[model samples]
Target: MAQAATITIGSKVRVLRVRDRIPADLVEALKADPTGTVTGFRTVDGQGIGLEVDLGAGKGAWFFDDEVTLA
Candidate 1:
């Protein structure tokens, strides 16, 4: 399997797909514009890593590592 790209704060990324449920507006926004900058990281379930992406216009959301890729 291909390994995911390494990401860090300020890195540009694009949403690949959402694995968890989120607000409808966020989902729509992602579908319309999937690219964003990595703002930070979060611990998910103590085993997974979640990325905080700034979608611009004050819009932001967290996505699992597998849900995004380097842009």
Candidate 2:
């Protein structure tokens, strides 16, 4: 398995891939510009890491560390 990328707040990143069940409004925006800046970090019970990816156009989403790369 590929090692997970390390992400930090304000880190620049590009989407490597995405899950299928994303919100409808974000689909085109995500595809148009996969690059985004990490705005915050999230965790489930302080466990797995989830990232706050901020793309322009009021678009942002939480992505797994494996779904993005440091840019």
Query: Which candidate wins on TM-score?
Result: 1
Candidate 1 matches the true fold with a TM-score of: 0.88
lDDT of each: 0.86, 0.80
State the TM-score for model 2: 0.81
| CA RMSD of each candidate after superposition | 2.2, 2.7
- Over 4 Å off, model 1: 1-5
Clashing pairs in 1: none
- After the best TM-score superposition of candidate 2, give how far the Cα of residue 45 lies from its true spot, in angstroms: 7.0
Ten residues in sequence with the least summed lDDT for candidate 2: 1-10
Clashing pairs in 2: none
lDDT of 2 by residue, 1-71 (tens): 13244566888999888865888788899778899999987784466677888998899998877788888
